[model samples]
Target: MKEIQQFFIRNFIAVPVSFGSWLYLLFGIGMNIFPATGLFIVLYLGSSFSIKQIQLSSNLKQLGMTRSEYKHIKNQLTSARFKVKQLNSFYGKVRSVQAFRQLHEINTISRKILGIVKTNPKKFYYVEKFFYAHLDSAVELTSKYSMLVNQPLKDKDLKITLQNTRETLVDVNKQLEQDLRNVLSSDLEKLQMEIDFVGVTMNRDKPVLEMKGDKYNDRK
Candidate 1:
């Protein structure tokens, strides 16, 4: 059933319209006037509308999302994934432990953020906003720093800029962690509140005894 639904989502535009066109062709052969032109128009319109309907229904069923919401989340994930790949590639080229260490940390956190987005796409709006705000700049800075480090010349200014960029990337990694925490803040808060409630109840309802002259008396 899942495979069938996936097939429909992928081929909804072509399959139905093609089937209808074939049927129309078969029937129109017996008629006095061939309806080739009309059939083409109907098939075109039918495919366009069917594509939209299928997309909306698929989004709702798969992600509990509207068409636009699903598209937005999907595009954001794609962009984030691309940035992660870029960072990972740069990490490979890095020779200095200091630079590679920060890039590795950034790559790990970036991948974690992507995993969170994939697992809970509905909760991805905050993550998407954060990615747009800071992720691209981090990628750009890392790429530039990697290029500078690879150059043979030991220019003092270039080294200074690279060190500064490395610090900024460290901050960016921290920002990614904070952003992920923000996305899960509601769930974390709920969990903490539940724990507190449990602790209070446990303490309040705990068994107590009254001692009378070394003899314990149970108070029911």
Candidate 2:
């Protein structure tokens, strides 16, 4: 229907009038009658206005809807991005201790990977060694930094780091699920569990929000 509308808009003058005007144009304008021309017009009009036209229009509307959905997703992405950055900054403030640094490095990498997952989830589905293959240095540095913060386990500092890590981990899981959906890889289930474990370790105190989204979208 849109195509037909567009065609009419583009070639408005080319659309023929009724049969009476055809006769007038034929005689008055000294035009030659072409049988094939009339046949083409009949075929084009019949097809353009048929049920198939409705289906095509519906499909185009769905495309528009999907584009809008993508925009909503972008908003979620922006929020996730800010959270990840906050986690990174928190990681950097930890004192320099080897064990704490190791833990920090892991946590940082996890957070960064979560960001990437949020931005381009298809990467998670395609890459075999996803975490290792796409390891960012910033992630590594942050992980090490986080670990360093945990060394002496000062009650106040440990409590704060735990809160930060928990928040970061929640964002990570949300991003991963968004980006890595419907993957055929066998490791997907295990990956989800591992992410959950990380979250549980970081926040033994807080309640985790169970996602209410559809497990499978009919149109995805």
Judging by TM-score against the true structure, name the best candidate. Answer: 1
TM-score of each: 0.67, 0.27
Model 2 CA lDDT for position 2: 53
Report each candidate's C-alpha RMSD, comma-separated, in the order given: 6.2, 21.0
* Tens digits of lDDT, candidate 1, 104-153: 77777778777877767787876765678778877888988888888899
Tell me how candidate 2 scores on lDDT: 0.51
Give residue 194's lDDT in candidate 1 (0 to 100). Answer: 100
Alpha-carbon deviation at 128 in model 1, angstroms? 3.4
What value does the lDDT take at residue 28 in candidate 1?
Answer: 55
